[model samples]
Target chain A: MAQVRNKQVLLKNYVIGFPKESDMEIVEGSITLKVPEGSSDVVLLKNLYLSCDPYMRLLMYKDTPVSLGFHYSPGSPLTAFGVSKVVESGDPNYKKDDLVWGVTKWEEYSLVPSAQILFKIDHTDVPLSYYTGILGMPGITAYGGFFELGCPKKGEKVFVSAASGAVGQLVGQFAKLTGCYVVGSAGSQEKVDILKNKLGFDEAFNYKEESNLDAALKRYFPEGIDIYFENVGGKTLDAVLLNMRSHGRIPVCGMISQYNLSQAEGVTNMAYLIYKEIKMQGFIVSQFYPLYPKFLEFILPHIREGKIAYVEDIVEGLESGPAALVGLFSGQNFGKKVLAIAPQ
Target chain B: MAQVRNKQVLLKNYVIGFPKESDMEIVEGSITLKVPEGSSDVVLLKNLYLSCDPYMRLLMYKDTPVSLGFHYSPGSPLTAFGVSKVVESGDPNYKKDDLVWGVTKWEEYSLVPSAQILFKIDHTDVPLSYYTGILGMPGITAYGGFFELGCPKKGEKVFVSAASGAVGQLVGQFAKLTGCYVVGSAGSQEKVDILKNKLGFDEAFNYKEESNLDAALKRYFPEGIDIYFENVGGKTLDAVLLNMRSHGRIPVCGMISQYNLSQAEGVTNMAYLIYKEIKMQGFIVSQFYPLYPKFLEFILPHIREGKIAYVEDIVEGLESGPAALVGLFSGQNFGKKVLAIAPQ
Candidate 1:
């Protein structure tokens, strides 16, 4: 085993509002990569690629009554999806050099006590880095949230917000594959282009440029939106509520626009949800973990046949990790933001 | 049959804000209550017990898209739930002396075609007056919304807003019967007492006196709310969102608090819905009409067995109808506000 060394990122303090760059700091110390001699069940892993997601911004806040996952405590490395290679195994099921995708620290290596949360990656035909995003949590999120929650049908008018982001991009592609009319809204013109020309969305709009989001939706969805995959919640959600068809379904995967705010903006047009009898559900990707194998079965064939496409904004090295993580909140990254720690 | 006369209540014009006494005026004219000569399936009857729901306040505004059911033309009688015996029947299923509950004109009588939206009151052991409130649409709303949408489990904490009102009162009773720890909020102390002492709620509070709604909810629901039957929206909903437990469900039956306002109030704590993975569904009673028979079968036995109790604020005559209906918006009525047109 390598000499015990721990390179960790710690939260300085609980964030009051929006998280600033200074809120998190990376520190270095030492620890053994292998479990101690007395320990019966502990595996050490070298994290290869880490996922930077918008929901992490929420963890910086102090204790709250509501949270889907564990709160990030001050002076602790943030929890996120990572691709790691098992170096030492305490469990009989895992062996050395077994690649896995699961929760890990935002550092070089981690000693995971229980291997229950980890899933062994079996498909080597695709890039291992895909486990950090497109083929991992976000991938299953798009698959389960859209098909299971959104219940998209062929010819339905589907609208996605934060269109070119990790989950939204995949949702648009999946909707298109199902023969639905899909439109998406993104922050930049470049993203709008990627949504339309590359991701195969029927239409795409730059929400930053549109003065009236409701009008933009009406123009794109003349008949009205049958399914809304809610990623950005606030004014965009209010607008989508007004343009939703009767019996429309909204799968609330994430609300990036409202996460960092001390008080989330009020949605004025939510009454439309009642008037149109809309079914809006908020779901965490973790709830569908049991479906991960099924998700892979559905997605892998598409990838091999070249029917599905995925994009990533890879930032190299551990030094650039903080900036890459924070870039997601500012909409600075072009696609799925990933940090590459080591080569396969 | 009596000579056909159409008595109608017309909107004086679009109401600017909250509807007032002067916003609607009643007018009378002659029309045939009998079905037209060549009509294949049309039934005409004397209208009775016009229900005044908060949603009607939205229809008073011009071009607001407020009518979720059907549009009302200028100078037309307002449409709502009413019980009436068929005076003339063109459809095969309906005939004279057969009482029905459905959309009817806000006047002395109405000419309804096909009886498609109407449901016959098969069980008359309960008060026929209940067809307008407890045993009718509001009853089905409370039943279907609580069981199907909210999915309340045994011993779960359930919260109902507008507790003393028509739909809310039943929801509280339904929760109590299901072995839930039910808490309710009302606008007045008297209503609160009825909720606790008379209606058998585990806890009840007058929201008007509570300085902090979130604190009030926390005090009443120490373990947090498992089901929130949302009838009154705005700040009440905001407070409920903050106190909801993980996997909480909110059935958006009505937003009585925001119905009369020209612009709806924004709920500030909506992000809690996402953080808690709450399932908030907005549904219409009309959508659950098909389940009414099953609902009555479930509820009537409860009523007969004395497991459920209800309260109604009855207005004696048609002249007091407008005020009785509008009383719901102001939280002036002690319980289900019903205008008694005729005794069964």
Candidate 2:
């Protein structure tokens, strides 16, 4: 078989503090796109759309001491939850021309172990890039974190920080769908408008405009918040603690604000957790992978019926991967950020 | 009935930082030792053993903003969870000479609402003073925070902070009773001895002696803590977050360390909650009152079988109340500090 030129995104160094585009480099590589003879463990994939998430910054570390997910090595191609098509399959579960989504390398082609293929993309009626986000990890993350961990009740006042981002937008919409009064906080008025007008949030505010987050929360939730879907942690979490009602729930999905900082901000209002009898729980998408099928059943219909809105901030080419990934920390992207390495 | 002398403890002023003995004043007042005319909702209580709890400091504030508890006024008698004897009652639930434990004033005589009486002392086989320590509000707090919230399985690794304090002592024993491996951290070597030698904990350490709390926790909970019954929060909680296993639970019973500081220590390791899929919940004793009967059924048997041991630091006379209550913040008491106001 003739080898093909493969363009890839590689981690140039172990990141400390905020990640930069220079931290990851685009380089030329070569690969033979074929499954080895007599192999029944791995599948060869053609990477299409790659997810740019806040959690990816953790993997940029040398050892990734805190993360439960696999670490990205300095010399290797960055690994991410991606939408791919199987070019050749050595496993019974996968076949040639089958669409799938899972952990794939940031290259034109990925020869990943079949176990990393989380789900065979069974439904193709939606956009293929949706598999990288809304129908994939971020979708399951919002679903499981909001519904499973939060246990939000009808008419409950819910607050979401980073409410215009990937998981936050979906979470806000989900809360509203569950009959909750959802309020979200975003960095820009543009993002806030999308959250309130497009994503169906009952109320949305630019956190940057508000001098006091506590006062902003009090204005939205005079009776106190019953659930807070936490994405951007640190001070937002502290302020949320003060405005939480008795027996409120805080589902901590991501700490985007703290990820880039050398020393994450200290949350001072933890005493409110005791005073308000709050249950603050943390969750990841992989933990909720078992519920993906059930999630698809609930979400696919909503997406089809135009009842749920999914916004994607996508840029073309593997060369754009590093900048798109770094942009997540700086809030440069508007919605569910994705790198379009190749088109369907 | 003749008017009787009531030596009461009153808040001298609104406390801003660490409480001082001067913050409280013990003065002689008079009370008509009776339930009063046609008072069907009140009880005349002769306060016996008044508990010196850390939660009391929050009540001492002019108007407690963070506490879900009633605030104490400067000129009035300080209220606390106390073991009392009913001298006169108009409620059907209580009777004359009935021994009970509930919220009562720091006085020789307290005219409390009958509804404030939490439990009648039916299990008199044990010391009546246990009502102020092992069988009182602290007891219910330990039980609910540990068993109900922690959900410990057999052979699970458990860690309790403030191991020799009122609630922590019982939590450690309860973990042992549930067949879990328990380690405790306290401020003194004396407390460590009581935890290891007397209370049946697997291991105990003096937290004050350790320069690095994270290293100390790692040395004890090398396998990572499954359940952390959080008593003293702040730095200890931040360290515990580093040592917690996947899906670990932290039941925040109290944040005694943060209570005295005008500005509570900032907890910075909150990102660990998402990384490790941890659940850190906070609960108050009042929420668990409905399960009091079931709690007594479980606890009374353990107390009778000598499987559980409770320690109390009892001081005599009403005048000593101010100093004893103030001592809790300074780590001046070794066990559950109680003021023995009057004999049974």
Candidate 3:
């Protein structure tokens, strides 16, 4: 077997606080372009696009919780959900030339188990990059969390935090699609503009400009919020708790604001949880993967008709992966941040 | 109509921080012996037992949330769940000399709306004082919160905070009745002893003595907690979050520790909700009232068989109501705290 040059991003050390680009290094490695002989569940993949998410930060620690499933140690390639093509296969489920998206190594080529392949790419009419974002993990996260957990009713008030990010943007649109009155908050004015004008949100605000988030939320939701899609926890969650109506639901998808802190900020207004009879639950995308087919059946027509829109912040080359992933912590990415390495 | 001297506990003023006996005062007032004429929903009651609860502290605030209902303005008798005998009735549902337990004013005689009566007292085999604790609002609170919200399975590890309080004591007993491995935490060693020896808890601990609450929880629940009945919020709740198993449930019934704080203590470990895939819900007892019949059927047998036991700390006379209610904030009451104004 011959070897080819494989550029990879490797974890240099365990990250304690805010992750910087220096925490990861781009290294040139090599891989054989074929699967190991007789391996029942292995496949070789050509990495196409990689996703940058807030939860990725949790896997960088020295000791992660068992439930998080995958974590990387020092001196090894980082792993993430990526859009890839099957180059060689030993698994009956996947074959050469098949396009797929799931967990893969942050390298030019990866040999992984077939179980990690969440779903094969079946629809090709939309942007193939969509599988890396709105049609993939983030999509299912917004769909299952909002519809299944939120249980939103028509004409109800809905609020989304980090509204311009991968999951938040889609949650806002889904709320609107369900006949809800939607309001979203983002870190910057540009993202706020995109949420209100482009994504069909009823209203949007630049949270950075608001001195009091509680007052800002009151201004947006005068009667009180019915469903709070909690993407950023900490003070944002506390403010939303105060504004939530009786019997409100909070589907906690991510807590981007607290992910990097050594000591998380305390949520003080939780007493409202009892007074208002609120339900707050936290979940990850994998728990909702069973809803993929139903999600596709509901989303595909809307995508083709341009009724539901999506945004992507694409950074080119394998070397730029570190900066793109780091940008997520600072709210630097305008939308779904993806690292594009190879063409289909 | 003849009037009788009605001794009452009235709110002196709105309370801010920790409540003192001075925040309430005994006042001698008078009430007519008959219900208001032609008022179809009005009932006259001879008040007997008044219960002290953590949620009552919220009603004393100048601006209570609207969902809480029935806030007492200054110069008015404080309202609480009590056992009473109806002296006169204008509603078709009740007749003179009927026994009932529900929300009633803190006075020797109360003229209240018929809707305030939660249920008629039908069982007299148990101590009537149980109506103010186990068989009344707190009873409904414990049964509904534990079985309905906690969702305990047989042999699951269960933890309860404020284990010696009226609601916590019953929740622990209910968890054990379901065949769960139960652990409870209280502020004092005496309460801890009562939990393990009298209430049938598998293990108990004094949370105040253990400087590190997280370590204490690990010691008791070695396999991690499957259910946590949260009665006291702040540090205990934060500590409990760190020890929860994946998909654990937290039924939040009260936040006694937070009631007296001008600014509530921050709960920092909420991010565990996501990592553990936890479902945390806050609910008042009234939301589960529809399940009262089922609760009564299940618990009546246990009480008859002596499988469940309860403790009460009774303070005599309406004048002592202030001290008994204030004692709750300082963990001064050993078990369920009740005020006895008159003999049935």
Candidate 4:
């Protein structure tokens, strides 16, 4: 059979400090739609959307010393969670036209050798793009970190840094669902409003406007914070440490604020951790993959029923991908930023 | 019978910065050995050795927030862990000549109103002074922190800061017993030798002598540290963070280095915690008091068999108590500094 071809975006080199558009380039490449003769375990897909995550910044570095997720190699296409339709299949489980979501190459199409990590998108009744954002890795991250690590109790004070971001938004909502008093901090007023008015957070503040985060937290959480979902590190972490109640738990997901800095800001108030008996645990979403199905089972219903809201800033075309990904560190992108590579 | 007199050491005022010898003054006061006619739960004892710990530095500050332990009041005797013999008892559980260990006033004699947190020392075969040092709060801290928080494995590289102090010494030994390659850092050459020779550590270095702590840690832990028992925070923590192996665990017991400073030192390398997926938990020993029996069950045998050894720099007489306790911040004590107010 004549083979159909696809295009891909490849990283140019390892990035240092903040990632620039020059670090990544959309290279013209071709992939066969069908498996070669005698190959029995392969599938080809047309990717519709790709997730832009903060963790991707780590992957752009030359050597990150083996972190939670798999590292991306320089000169290879960046990998991320994406929604795709299988165009051809040699695997027994998947068939042509089956929609799936999982880690895939940053491209319009890919020929996957194995589909072990892939999950078929069964609930198309909800937004198809949800598979790349709220119903995927970010969704599972919020559930696992808040419920499993944070251990929220009703009426307890919950504080979230980067509350307007993908995982942070879900975390705030989850805290609200658990009947906890939730407060969140964002970089701008729009995000603060979304947290308080749209996401149902008890209070929200623009950390940029607040001169003193410690005093701001004291005002928002007068009694002190019981749970802190740490998304932004540096000064925010130091302030949160001081505001933590006795036996407080902090589930560290990401530190967007310090990701791009050559010398990350130092946290000075860590002594509070000992006095408060704080338990701060850093976790990767991949560690909780077994719970993904259970997480989808729990979150999809709320998303479908419109009880849970997810916001995404969609950047069109593969050429714009680099800027979209870099926007996360600068706080320029609102909500879950994603690149829509192809039209439905 | 005439009432047994209660002798007390009173704090004259709130100390500023480093405590001076004149800051704490011992005063003699008398209390009836017998409980009041209506009281049902009181005990009297003759205090032996009072534990001199770095945390006591916080107690001298007048306006510090209330914590799980008692706060020192101006013009009142300071209180800490002490090994004592019951001279009289009103509580049915305690009797004359019973050896006990608990938080007690720094004095020759104490009239304990309630024996709530006190433990009866059954293992008298070992040195009674152990109750104030290795076999007491410091021992339990090392045991719980290294075992529970660190979750060390054989062949793992363990790094301990303030390695010759009361807690750090035991942590090094405990890590060695678990078959881990342990390295430690102390302020002086004497303490470093004690760590390497007496505490069974594989390597030891004086942090004060090293020009760069990161380079020092790299020299000791070539493969990177799997566990860091953080006692001296500030620059040491920053260095350890840089050299931490992936999935490293840091059990923060105390930050002696930053305790005396007007402002805490900023830790610049905390971003490594996220990149390495490290788990840093700060714990207070009082939280694990319920595990005392289990701790004693495991540790007593080790002590009696001489499998574990302890060091104490004892200062005789109550007059030297203030200087001894204050000397800890300056690293003046050679071993687990203790004050011998009265001999058993």
Worst 10 contiguous positions by lDDT, candidate 4 chain B: B60-69
TM-score of chain A of 1: 0.97
Off by over 4 Å in 1: A1-5, A64-69, B1-7, B30-33, B64-68
Candidate 4 per-residue C-alpha lDDT over B1-344 given as tens digits, one digit per residue, 9 for 90 to 100? 56555667788888777788888887777766665666558777788888888888877777663285588987788888888888778888888988888888788877776554368898888878898888888988999999999999999999998888899888988888899999988889888888878778899998889999889988988899999998988999998999998889999899988777778999987777767778889988887777888988888888888778787888887788888988898899887988887878
Residue-wise lDDT of candidate 2 within B1-344, one digit each (tens)? 88999999988898988888899898998988877799999999999999889998988766675554456988888888999999999887888999999989888999988988888898889988899888888888899889999999999999999999999999999999899999999889988998999999999999999999999999998899999999889999999998899899999988999987778888889999988889999888888988888889989989999989998999998889888888898788888999999999
Candidate 4, residues A1-344: lDDT per residue as tens digits?
55544566788898888898888888877765666666568777788988889988887777764464456876788888888888877887888889888878789887776553368988888878887788888988899989988989998999999898989999999999899999999999998888888889899999999999999999998899999999989999998888899989998888888887888898998888788888888887777778988998889888878889988888887888888987888898889988898876
- Tell me the lDDT of model 4 at A342: 84
A239-312, model 1: which lDDT tens digit per residue? 99999998899999888888777778998777777888889888888888889988999999998998888889
A174-285, model 2: which lDDT tens digit per residue?
Answer: 9989899999999898998898789989999999999999999999999999999999899999999999999999999999999877788999999888889999998777
> How should the candidates be ordered by TM-score, best one leading?
3, 2, 1, 4
Candidate 3 per-residue lDDT over residues A1-344, each given as its tens digit: 87999999999999999999999999999999989989979889999998888888899988775365678988989989999999999999899999999999889999999888889999999988899889999999999999999999999999999999999999999999999999999989899889989999999999899999999999999999999998989999999999999999999888899988999999999889898999999888788999999999999999999999999999998799899889999999999999898988
In the range B1-344, model 3's lDDT, one tens digit per residue, is 89899999999999999989999999999988998879999899998898888788999889886355588888999999999999999999998879999899999999999999988989989888899888888998999889988999999999999999999999999898899999999989899889988999999998889999999998888889999999999999999999999999999899999998889999998888888889999998888778878878887788899988989999899988898889899999989999888898
Better model by lDDT: candidate 3 vs candidate 4: 3
Candidates 1 onward: DockQ, in order: 0.66, 0.77, 0.76, 0.63
Report how far off residue A68 is in candidate 2 (Å): 4.0
Interface RMSD of each: 1.7, 1.4, 1.3, 1.6
